[model samples]
Target chain A: MSEWWTYRPSSFLLFSARTYYRLFELYNAEIWPWQVLALLVGVAILVLLRKPGTWQGRTISALLAASWLWVAWAYLYSRYASINWMATYFAAAFALEALLLIVLGVGHGLVWRPPAAWISRAGIGLATFAVALQPLIGPLVGRSWSQVEVFAVAPDPTVVGTLGVLVLASGWPKWLLLPIPILWCLVSGATAWVMQSPDAALMPAAAALVIVAGGGSVLSRMAPARDASGTPALD
Target chain B: MDEIIKAPPLSRRRLLGALVATGAAAAVGPRISAAQPDAIITRPIPSTDEKLPAVGLGSWITFNVGYDDVARASCAEVMRDFFEAGGRLIDSSPMYGSSQATIGYGLYTLGKPPALFSADKVWTSPGSRGPPQIEVSRKQWNVPRFDLLQVHNLLAWKEHLPTLFAMKASGQLRYVGITTSEGRRHRDFEQIMRTQPLDFVQVSYNVLDREAEARILPLAQERGMAVIINRPFRQGALIDRVARHPLPSWAGEIGCVSWAQLLLKFIIAHPAVTCAIPATTRPAHARENVGAARGPLPDKVMRQRIESLVEQL
Candidate 1:
């Protein structure tokens, strides 16, 4: 048998760039008007991101949970899986992410820190892009408006939006919520790269942005920890 | 052995060669059809002496269109062109997402062209599930019975081969075989080829990818197994590369107008190969591919020359 490393990214592509994009066209047409509902949900999540409180956090989390569950069933399971065998596993991951959002984000009510000034700006920027700007990128790149990938309705924007929200909230929520979206960005980015899509850089760019922006805060917080003697301790 | 060595129509092939030499072959333009004397070129299945067209259709990435009415209708047009050009043998697998359904749509659109030599694969786990998976594939293609059923990529071949053998034994299938692509698992593939009563074995082979020539091709000849060549253009990469260079001056001798035909002819010209299935989305390309099967094939010396030239490019 050939070793796993023998495979290239192109080896896994079972459909063409045209076919992959046409899937979104067919899917978007099949579930009409739901795109508006999904957009409203994105708007709600953004609104709650600004009102920093326990109930607000829980509301944001619940909205995200519903968004993810909807994507898991409506897009990944029903539409994308028809062209990609790996989408079934992606749907399961989305469902798992939704479950985590419900249990950790909604039930426990994550703590929202007034993020470090730059981090807060970055978070709002990313959230805005995910909900609003990303959809327009599809149409700008010559794809029909019907094929536009919307927030919460498509995996790319959903994952990016979740990352933006996670950046605004602090603590263990990042540890639980960040990995799936980060991993999904990498997967979706690679898929776009293989398909030679114009938005090939967007997902990976989002991932890198979160890692640098999100990871920097963690390091900064770690730097402040000291012994009672007012000296840093060595491990 | 004699059944596999049928000669091309000398008189008509010479006429095609003459047209190519005169630079008039460009005007032939989808004129090749079953009604023409040299339109259909067939080779015998070694085990059964059943004739299959030299070129067949493969549905890898090309026909995986999922409910896109435009793409599905385009796929149907490709099928229409393929059948009109005297081609049969459409190959697909469950691993190819929605391809079976797309083919079903095409077949339904074409009224399930009687010339279709339906080829599909059994791909699933536990070996016990193979039969049900094949049934699902059968329903997807909407065919009464597949003309050939292969164990895809040698996945669970030890368990699935027996199921295929039993099906063949009971006359539920016309032929049984195994398949692998991109030059994988040749050692295990050979073991099955040697031990099993296989009618056909599909493998990846092209002008650039010749790893199969070392052992697989010779072994197939030795075992009397008809060979089906897959990835004849390395999923279009090889053709795209060679298309950059001009066709060799000697191409007209064999009536090949484009590099796709040359690459496909190189594969199907092998004595052990019964067919080479190259997938394409355009109806014009489908007709062009079937055109490769007609006219004279390269001899041993010319085959070596063609290989050497392609390697340098």
Candidate 2:
């Protein structure tokens, strides 16, 4: 880890931020009108989670998987890895996360009844933060518009929000879903720290929030069954 | 690695004169060659009779400052320090974000210094990307043409080599070279060196990472290829570790007043090494790095001792 730590902070940050800026500009120019569709889809997921309609889990997971796949192909593999070699591994992990989400939710046709617990409430807040508030972190911090990292369009917040939404899944596979977001946050945080970036605190902060909230939700879900029947809930 | 610079600006000329009057360049004491005064050392290019300075500035991360005005201004000052201290070779790549553009900006701030021996790299290609990337690189550097055009990390090199040769053959460039700053490609880099008709090669070579010493440096010598050493301070870690302690008593034998100069002098001392490009953003650090080019370089015996001393630290 120290060996990776040996790099000059600017080297990693410049490659990352520059690649991000380029992809952002390209995405903005080419997909100017279509971005509204992605935003509307994001709003639909939030509305579905708020009121458990038919196949709501399936819908949210499908949207989450699509976002992951898009960023994996468009940003990580196609753009970021061209400069930083580590992004190739990240792209693979993201693609795998997308497939897992699709199989677990879309394949099974699970219904998402939004949890009534405080942890799930907090998870909703986090998902909202990633979608609506995360993009503003860049502009509010004084970065140029070209350098803005938008959720669904950018890898970091897309993964962050996905983790928040997944934590609300009552019976979903938490183990399979948590690692990629956690790992990505660590990598992203280290990279930001190196770059002297304003968002340095955001990634590690997201990782910590995911661990506490995701783990708490899973624990809370297990506790009710174990207390009543003297058996672990997942089995 | 040689820095091609003009006569100093008036303010820096006064600073140089004052340093000379104080019996050293900056705070470095004594003289290895008093007659030469502050004249920077240069080594032959091997392929050509032209001499390159022993020290040059690298533009990997430090010079890739995008559009940040404060960072860009700092880069300009660093470039000024480098040229004023007799630097010439300013190396960059298309892979390094805005590095080529920043180098152009730094030089532009300095009135497009004549001492500039612009060196750049082509990082993309299916063969067609080479021409356009070079065109972009040329505009970024704001130079009519670069002194050297290198294949970056050997990516699509087979595809781009022909274009490089054609560029050189057509006088768009003076030298055609290949560069690999990663340890993973040392074997292939050596293979290319032995077989390719190259004028120069850049590689990661430093005190802590002596992997290049076994084969790459020797191959460059046997092949008469000019060598440019990167990561001489292991991308700032090695020197930062050594900088924690005071300089050793015998450090002055090669006239190193700082750990930066000591680390730099060690690399450039290798007779096969034509230049060592250490990137920096601070004008003070740039001046310190250029100091290694002055006075004397360490010989083989001293290089070993320098290695041993640094290891002990």
Identify the candidate with maximal TM-score: 1
Task: Give the DockQ (2 decimals) of all models.
Answer: 0.67, 0.18
Candidate 2: where is the Cα deviation over 4 Å?
A1-111, A114-158, A170-190, A193-235, B1-35
- State the DockQ, from 0 to 1, for candidate 2: 0.18
Error of 1 at B283 (Å): 1.0
Q: Write the per-residue lDDT of candidate 1 for residues B1-313, one digit (tens) a residue.
A: 2222233345554455435534533433343221232445688888988888899999999999877889999999999988877788999999999999999999999998999999999887779899999999999999998889999988888899889888888888989999998888899899989899999999999999999999999999999888899999988889878998999867756678899998887888788888999999999899789878876667777788889999999
Per-residue CA lDDT of model 2 for A11-104, tens digit only, reads 4554535434555666565556656676776777778778654478778889989989988987788766644656788999999999988987
Model 2 chain A is weakest, by summed lDDT over 10 consecutive residues, at A1-10
Interface RMSD of each: 1.7, 7.4
What would the per-residue lDDT of candidate 2 be over residues B214-250, giving only the tens digit for each residue?
A: 9998899999899998888776778778888999866
**Candidate 1 lDDT score at position A102:** 97
Indicate the docking level reached by candidate 1: medium
